[model samples]
Target: MNLKTIFFTIAFLASFHIFSQNTYVFLGSYNRDKEAESIQVYQLDSEGRLTKVASTTNVINPSYLTISPNGKYIYACTDTKTPNAGSISSFEFNPKNKTLTFLNKQTSGGENPVYISVHKNGKWLVNANYTDGSVAVHPLLENGIIDSMAQNIHYSDRSIHKERQTRSHVHSAVFSPEFDVLFLPDLGADKIRSYAFDENQKKPLTETQIPFTKTDLEAGPRHFTFHPNQKFGYCIEEMSGSISVYTYKNGILQQIQRINTHADEIKEGFESSDIHISPDGKFLYASNRGKENNIAVFSISENGFLKNIGYQSTFGDHPRIFAIDESGKFLVATNVISGNVIVFKRNPITGLLQKTGTEVKMENVSCVQIKKYY
Candidate 1:
């Protein structure tokens, strides 16, 4: 072959190798009968198909999962409703084998731990317990093991909803983009509470003087996501089926706008579960569970307000959680009631999702997270 032919062949091989890299998809599930593994791992191809790779048994209802910022560890909040029975488990992730090695488990400081987030620095792990209306922080050892609880805060406030908001129910604990603040959304209290986070300190978080931004009575803030610019935040209100946009500065949140997630009239039983912003920050997506069973798509304006674009059917039931891959090429929604995960191909320009014809059957799948591994 000529020198030019050799160069072209080398370039083509290099591009093909990069395109063929597989992605690791981690799933968290609610295994009530102990028949299914609580955590499972799958390999996702470039076309969005999933093939099971590894699974760990006996995790006992690991309904939510989060990976460390460095991608070295996986953290899961075990949903146990008994008083003080809830716990968080740590696992050392091996990207080579697509397996998780159990590290150690610790008390989650309350019951029914539903959500967990690791600090950007990977030194701390924070979780929310829904049943007992509490949030806890745990120190992380260098080896991916979790130390005893560093702090646990409980709430007693209640909202106007008599049946659902009878008392405080903390749903999500997330850190700001800069890691200077932490936001805990209480679904039962209708409040998005903020705390000053000092990663250098032993505890690392304390209630801010201007502690919280309260949503409308019975709004039931469940999960929140910050815009890529760090200038705005969006909270998905579970009870009201709306998204609240807020101006965020120096750890304080000021509500700016509240818009419905459903395209039609707001009806009962349309519960919103999770919210995520596209990697490019041009679009925002939220999963609606009950009667709608679809993912709402919105265009994010330069000023951070959301414009409803459209909705895409999840092709399953009760989409409790959904994740957008880092490349922005694929999206996956986990249907907890349907026991399946549906994948979609995203239109980057229009911000719409089309079913990719890729589905994986897993019993009681609740959370889906994706990471690219070479």
Candidate 2:
């Protein structure tokens, strides 16, 4: 064969080798009142089969987790420290045994760290501290472990209502698709703060900080989901159990629609929990925790509008987080109060979910995240 043909054959073989590997799921559990909590690992085979593997070798209540793009490392938020200050821990996963080893830990610079996210380039780690109303950024070492805090910012703003928006509560911070902006959702402030992501600096250039387009005086936005195409975004409100959808273009947000997650009426103490979009960009799902513990499904239009499809019971109480497998064939809901992870089969075409008999046993499971591995 000629030299060019030989090069083409080698490239095709390398691509096929990487594609044959399967995906894995990592479940981060929060043991609120207990010690010695761990990160659970599970493997997903090519046929969509799940097999539980060995748990992480550390003891920390990792309420939230963010995996690296190359699938080499995972960073978890440990929120069980004193006076309520939080910490972030790093781990190295071994696909041979499907176990993780502790690498390092650093202070998150705040309290009740609820969410963790890594930049697409795997260079920076960001977190949302719920209780202390702060955001922290850290630089990741070449070995996929956190080095230390690079920047920490305490957010302050006006609280319109006394009931829910009494103080500042930073729930989650997520990077935009282009990695040029960071969206900070503060539940207590009832607004999403947008900041320009600086490529040359460690911290965000807050001089360009801009608030949400449609502010809910007391709606309490908790989590956000970006569309697959990166043209639009949606946020779920914890105070009112509603979703605010917006169009995002050129780093600006334009309000498109706001829809309620509840079917009929919301009672006194209802609060929404988590929001996620389908892998195919055809549906959106949000969890509601109140007298009724259920997941509301909404169909997505090509123009990025949402329409309510139906609701399904979470099977257990207080379904705080749910994860859709990478193949979009399964949805697992983590019922925090009930200590059960209920699995459901999802119909991608119809956007309907069917409950599967499989479930996992864990104590105070707060977050579920899945990724593919060999």
> Whole-model Cα lDDT per candidate?
0.89, 0.81
Q: Give the number of the best model, judged by TM-score.
A: 1
Off by over 4 Å in 2: 1-21, 32-37, 45-49, 80-82, 209-214
lDDT for each residue of candidate 1 in 251-296, tens digit (9 for 90 to 100) = 8888899999876765677699999999999999999998888999
User: In lDDT terms, which candidate is top?
Assistant: 1
Clashing pairs in 1: none
Candidate 2 — worst ten consecutive residues by lDDT sum? 205-214
RMSD of 1: 2.1
TM-score of each: 0.95, 0.90
What tens digits encode model 2's per-residue C-alpha lDDT throughout 1-374?
A: 99999999999887545433456777777765434456787765433445787676455678888788888898899854446568999898877666788898999989888899988888888988988788888989889889778889897664787755667899999888898888888898877887787756866545463555445767888999899899999999988788999999877888889898887766556578899888899999999987778999999998999999999999998998888866677788888888888778788988888877767778888888877664
Report each candidate's C-alpha RMSD, comma-separated, in the order given: 2.1, 4.9
Model 1: residue 239 alpha-carbon error in angstroms: 0.4
